[model samples]
Target: MNHASLPTTDLRARQARRRSLAFLLFVLVALAATLGGPVEPAVKLLDESQLVHATTAAPPVEVAAPMTIEQLRARVAAVLEREGVPGVGLAVVDRDGVRWAGGVGLADRDSGEPVTADTQFRVASITKSFVALGVMRLVEQGRLDLDRPLRELMPDVAIANDWDATSPITLAHALEHTAGFDDMRFNEYFSAADGAAPRAALAVNPRSRVARWRPGSRESYSNPGYTIAGHAIELATGESYESFIEREVLRPLGMPTARFRRSPEYADRLATGYDSPDQPALFRPIWHAPAGALLASPRELAELVHFWLRRGDRGGPALVGPEALARIERTETLPYLGPDTNYGLGNYGDVSHSARSRGHDGGLPGFLSAYRYFPELGVGYVMLLNSTHSLRAYLEIRALLFAYLTGGRAVPPPPPRDPDPAEVAAITGYYGYESPRMQLFGFIERAMVGISVRPDPGGIALEMLTGGGAALVPTGDGGYRHWREGGTSVRLTRGDDGRRILVGGLTYFEEHSYAWAKTRLFALTAALLLIQLAPAWALLWALLAGIRRVRGRSIAAGEFALHAWPAAAGLAWALLPLLFMHMARAEAYTTANPLSIALCACTLLFAACSAAAVAEVVHASVARTVPLSLRLVPTAAALASFGMTLYLLFHGMIGLRVWAW
Candidate 1:
């Protein structure tokens, strides 16, 4: 299994997207789970002592052959121990049967329960696998049209899109994640309405369902897309999403233990999920089960792998024809991570093993899971972890399992075929991401993940804003292949959109002065931070001066005015991280919550304070009584603060109510 997630599809709560959003957007990532949904909680790692994260690149993987089953288990155990993971449940399978199904380490630190094959772990977004199968079943039965307009299917559901008349949303677009929808807002991410209808779950924030661009234009990983699909399933089948999936997908696969919700009967059977070694992450009900709510054992997940390898068939009538199943595993939209790792329906391709493969990776709260297989190779594996902090360990263990399954044998890359000169000419330019997984932080992300493309002798050179460059060599067809490390993932393509958009690995980027955006935004940000330092130092000086005045020493009132007001503004801004860090545990990114309200109010307060400071700074600077250097300090600080206000105003961040937004 290829364990690493695509930058766009990767869960945001606490992992890849969370940290980035937090860093660029007050690292509010600590505010909740990852960007995809509740599964990827975005927590600032305070308990670093308990969970050593994957900050550095993993050790190089080798495809050494003839690795024994015992060796595989040993290696995985060593990785877990080294990385301080509590436990994991693993299952390896081929067309024949399961080669292994077991667990390692402590399932519960307090209880001393070891992880076992039957230990139930929340599979997070991998629940979508069942939904995908269910949707495909409906397609097979001619009940749900994959390409029919979603508006026609469910007129009751409201979705705002300017291009609705031109490009309507469809079931295939939802399943494929090309519906052009923004992810759920902060409030929606934390919605824990147990037993709520799928439609009601969506009604938490209908505004989030608005499309940033035309439907089916590009793919951005969306948690609610799956949720919306669940609602459509209910409409089509005259059955609830949870009931229908359990009856049609799970039972037919003989996964008796697989379920959508928690039950008292399965209490002891569940693994204790953890965010840290001593700190357990308690399970909370999420609004939509289709997005990330499935709970299953590793043994049951093994059956899921078998179902995929068998081409969506489960012993009896095939859930989907071989052709439809094949369609689900092939990427038609932009690349997710690379050409080889493009996303299909609920499934995505993975060539990290140097062989053609299809699978899904998921995360939520204290759990992480992956379901993968090389259909052509007829082998795959399923992994479920009870801890979220052990990504380094996760990657290493996944690599080892693949080595054991494939005997370290490699597959060759396909022969190269360059795009037509006209096509290449049209695509080579700067582009910015229109699809922000977190809409509140969209402007920040545009600068973060934007890229500049240019024609290269090989094919195209992709330069991302956050460092790293790739040469996309063409691999026949219209798609461009991307190779990184020893494996290839994702692809770059001008997608199904009529706009002739330049599309590639992750996010939906449109032509823009992305380089200019990155350069100007960073420049302004740096200038503001640097300017704030003067006021920060002035505040400290003012504190000492105030003490001296109390002791009967004289100091100029002009200097105090210059220092205090701008200093207050800087301090107010600085206080946010500390306050946010304190509130991280509460995940207070919602608008209704007092803390969330305060969070937004504080930003405006900073602006208001900043505006007031500018006038005081002007008066202070013109005062002949104040020293020239001291006068200069607050003047520069005020200007920077004012500039920042305009920038924030332009991007609509001034009065941002994160949760409601």
Candidate 2:
């Protein structure tokens, strides 16, 4: 009998069967987890210094004595250490006096150079306040009007079409954020352009730039507008913007250390900014100067604040008249920041934890700074850190200010309300919406659950839930509206079956009906199931196996596994959505080892496939001296692979959730 004609134990069929079994095993593992299981938080890699702060309260004790300069220095130093900030400088000002001016930590951590009160730091956007003062000074000098058209000073500048109305852009418009420009443009104006020539380029291309809204129609903070306004002061006075500012504002106020230069004149004491502890060398001074570029010592900055506290008076011609200075204090809507906040001229005013406060925050390459004053409590604070992670520093300063000045009547943190059970139940289902028309919907616990929305060609999509109601997130308007699509409206209808939701033109029957509103979670679940081969690694691997077998006389299991390794990795990729969903859904599940499950699954799958391929070779062994007993080895190997796969599946599902729960 010719070997070609002999009934061939099909190796391909055996391999396919093995792969099918592997897939089934994968599904089983996923199904076990999906059905119901314990969940836990996944492990993460973080530095030892990255503190996990708990919501701990200070023990009952008398409020500390009125904070002295010495007390402030020690407190600030401790805070810098706790935050891993390389260094910091703080200045405290009051109605009658300045106190607690000092710095802490190494200006150069490696060199061990200590930071001092005079150590210079790029004040970042706090420079905007100085620029604002300069602009107002020009206004005081009758060189510019706050409410005049910016186009008048810089003829090349393109004023927004909306500002063409008789109420042309004015100093007030620039100060109040009514100029139809935005933050980054202002940042680029100063930082992007080194000197006058590049700034002149900005004046010509104003229309292509992004604006928060039409000028005077909305309250959008415009950083570029201030820079432009600063330019206008230069244009009108025939003086460079920096020179004009120094002559008009900082010089008159005795803030000698303050200057806007490409590089600090005194680099020895300048605190080197840091991106992070690990990334120590990401510092560059390109287009960062206008918005956050000016360098000043804490003492100089404190004096600047003192000038404002003294109502811009230096016994000579005031930097700004009472009326102009008052504009800096008046609240204007802060659309760029948030609806709940406002800015007056260059200063920020907001209600934090429900207490009214005023301040400006600045962040740049490696520095963060804030200067806030509570007029009601007769206190002010300045915080400057040589690291980007300055939020902790900001909070510490706020806490200190609150403790010492507000008689320890801390602004109460917002109370947590138990989630709406009925709403949760209604929003537990999935829903969808369209885009451009840019719509999205999702629900959970009978209320809206997930908010992750992706836009499709015509609209957007949401997940499914049990309830009929779904949220409609409109991408066009940049706000979510609750409405019914497909023609139905959201109105509660009482029927013989009880109350049901009617939304997007469809009346969901029984509130958990098939035609209920879709949600983000439901969309995501459906997409994951429908599009399981996304990495396409599995399909790609199978195809490659076929191609390799055709291309060569034989194939190596190791080679096949090498090419298909990415597919093995895809098994884990497929489970990520499910893992995240379970994590979010079951709050008790604090940690889940997705990577472990993936590794075990890949190994089991790869091993089973390899065992089958080995068996195929063994069954048709050329030597035939390979005993029938060896065939039993393949069976045993298969059984072991199956057993391991099952174990991983069960643990991945039931064990994780059970352990976490």
Candidate 3:
């Protein structure tokens, strides 16, 4: 009876298993049918002839046809929607005149007011071009000379230059940003009292007036230098820079709306600038108006661009003579700033894609603008945006417009030149500039953000220790072009002291020994890592000691203090910057803020604590009270922290007083 029952049960189990597998197969077949089968051939391969043909074939044709006004408008609207730009005003000018002029997005998002062609916006640094026009007008009148020493013309203007005996700063140097002056420091720029005279505004930071290098030797962008040039205009013409520019330049070009300040007529029509959708930008008076502070509508700015493209061939009123305009358009060859680009009197010159273009870009807290003119093509563009987001959108649009204007011919980048290994090695090093423009903080910036140039297979790569980086490619000339940034380049030159000087965009950096930079970087990295990890290690050690105490062992007071100091120092170092950031969010943190004072105090205290911790670890290592393993970690941490503190001290950050500078 038992044998029969077992055989029956095994036969029933085998049948059930077969039924289950059959059902699973049916479900998989149903899923495959529902999903649909692949449409194209799954395994297609090209023959040898097809492969060769594909490799040798020309590239696909690009969209080179000129876009209609409606098409351009649609594209701009798409970009505005995608970028979340609040408002933008645009004007495109051809040889005949404005091809199209209009606005996109909202002038006031809350009010639902659409931006119009006549809506005014802050043009920021584009003001430099107008100021340059004023200076050139004076030059044509023989009231000023570009090459004349500025001090000779405006004796009252106090500028200190140590690199040269004569303190030679010229009008051209000031206009071209080659005066060797440092940029206005945080305090000088933000804490400047409104309604101050030009001289008084400059006096706000006397140290910034001093040259960081010899005048006309290197190009460094300096807003304060432009202000000084504006003052020179006043001295030469006995008229204010703004008044002269308005009467002679703006009025002549039929751009009466283009002025340095908010006039009554254009006040209500001004676009509301924004830092973001939620953050409204408040008005801050620009003391250095000549550097950046122009307000104009897109149409008015296009008028100014038209004047340049015509090369002073204004049918009615001319702002500058043909000869002066030529001088303004010609790019300088001496004291080079870039390989394919140069700063003209009040304009920037660039040869990219085999086309030479002149224009300027402007930026401020909540506004960004650009005006470019391709003289050969007799085409120009003006872009004004009320938001800083998507700052590069205008540039991309410019490129598209240029391609269409050029009949779709691709303007390839300059051919890369083979770099000499020896030359590359000679230039590969760390370079730093003393940013005396930032005053006290400038010293700290120089130490923390030095430029590092490393040799590479193609050429050299230059990087800022603080953040941004660029790849350098040799440009056939004895200079290197930024592989991606077409208009920017660097030249290697010798300083007055016979040391290697790297001349980039608007500043010069003196080369530093690789050995020195490497050691500093290693010490900095080690210290940063140790300080960041101090609190975690300290807590772990404390926990372990507590476990020992629970097992009937107690740690000495000396040992406890040794661990405590590092934790305390680390917290202080980390918390201070965090606190500053918190204040910065509230718009309460500034160079002159009391929080800066507290930061300085905490930094110095941390350094002191770090020094004590180093001593304690050294003593512990010598006494051999702790085991070798325990001693090693503590010793390394202490030494790293101490080294960082020393570096900070050397850079004037440990006990720096922001207000004093």
Candidate 4:
């Protein structure tokens, strides 16, 4: 008849009903927003930059040549269909004017509606270009210059190589991404607070990694560069990044829909992006304001492109002079292109090792967008999609469509095949991934490899390794290649030893390689690891000292034992794993995350706890055994003291010192 035995059937049913009703209400609200929202105008301006006046009126629009327009539409449709793209919005601009504009498919597939030209898709990293343009606006005003030392603008700033040479980084370098800085984008936005606090630190103080090249010596595409650019823009304009962009770029371009909201207010008209169903939601309050955090419909962005195409001739003074626009478009600085790539100010120029067009391709966790303009043919295209698969499809379709627009031929490639035997054998091995924040090793079993991600989920996330691994054909050279669905590529590098292979910066361990023989030696040495005894010996010395200090005292049995071997053994066991793991590591980089060190420290603490418990059990000294028959309490309390010591130890080991040094 107690509370536990009470029936409470009505209360339980009511609670269940409430949960069900709440869930249904959420679904109904979402449905209402998607299906009942008002249809916005095809080209609505949500905001524009007020800083740069748009003195000129919108340039007269031009219809494409009949043949050209038809070809462009058909090509766009084919690309969208082939790639299973849910929807796309395109803006074509040339020297004459904005030549063609349109949208295809549904912006929201779940809503079962077609994408209007105005359906805003988050433009992802294209926001970086806008940020750069804002900085240039200040330069045009004579408020800032291209070559002034950044330290002068904001003293105590520590951008990598900011003040190294006579020709230090200028506004030009910041705008063009030639500032010798490593690419680091702010990711604090993924948190609930959207990383506001951390972002504040990032804005106030920018850093550059120690570089092999000097500032502006070689270009490296850097998100951190844009973040610094935004910071510098703030200093120049006396505004936050958000206010500056709102006042300078969006207000002038008449882009009212663009905003950096933690949650999109126009969720109904705004296309929702999806990675997997459960991809972690990312928040970036700092980054959302600039580098990769703006959202606008393709239709809105088309107007933005048109504005840029017209060189700011929209009823106001030019947002950017024709000369500055030309500078941004031209290759004033080159991000050291790999064997097959090149980048200019916030835009990739020669992505395919060819000179077909200029634009930037943005790919993040749940977004993909490509904004390009072909000045030669006076045709440009903007492709924005919600799915992760959208980029490849968008690029492929765009490339083929470009051929159609340029009067060139489009020939599709052949299908996939089983991998070559030699090629498969060549890549078979254990590979080590040594990034700054992650250290993992994977072993190839036949064609598939299993990776162990320590202290977290340890398995493959994507079935498609290399994305096109199973489809690749081996060339005469040992390397294998595949024409990825997008304008993307993959290449494998082999060592001169002819056995070692490095894929995606990871070293593959091969069974047939000369290094294979060392595995046996490794196993043998592991079995004979008396090497850990050194730490054990040290622990024993400390234990003996504790015993001497407590000589002749009627210490509790648990306390006496804690003054004996438990503390020593605990320290030894903890150091054992860390030592072996360190032996296996190659080098540490600056970008390493703090979690890696935390895992190792946790191991040490757990070992200490185990040793302390064992000592207490052996001693069995306690006044409370009659109640709970416990033996470890006194020793556990002693180890708790060590546990507190370890908290400090861990922080020191894996903190700012590890990085700042």
Please identify which of the two predictions, 1 or 3, would achieve the higher TM-score against the true structure: 1
Candidate that scores best on lDDT:
1
lDDT of each: 0.70, 0.49, 0.66, 0.46
lDDT of 1 by residue, 359-444 (tens): 77777778888878887779999888888876676667777777788776665546566556776777777777676766667767
- Greater-TM-score candidate between 1 and 2: 1
lDDT tens readout by residue for model 4, 488-545: 1223344333434333211122223224334433433332232223234434544654
Q: Rate residue 503 of model 1 by lDDT.
A: 47
Candidate topping TM-score:
1
Span of ten consecutive residues with least summed lDDT in model 2: 47-56
Query: In candidate 3, which residue ranges exceed 4 Å CA deviation?
Result: 1-66, 191-196, 314-317, 329-338, 350-354, 392-409, 412-475, 480-488, 492-502, 507-512, 586-592, 618-628
Please tell me which model should have the higher TM-score, number 2 or number 4.
2
Looking at model 3, report the run of 10 residues with the lowest lDDT sum: 41-50
Which whole-number lDDT from 0 to 100 does residue 76 have in model 3?
66
Q: List, in order, the clash count of every candidate structure.
A: 26, 76, 2, 39
Q: Relative to the unseen true structure, what is the C-alpha lDDT of residue 377 in candidate 4, on a scale of 0 to 100?
A: 40
lDDT of predicted model 3: 0.66
Candidate 4 weakest ten by summed lDDT: 48-57
Model 4 has a clash total of 39
For candidate 1, the 10 contiguous residues with the lowest summed lDDT are 47-56
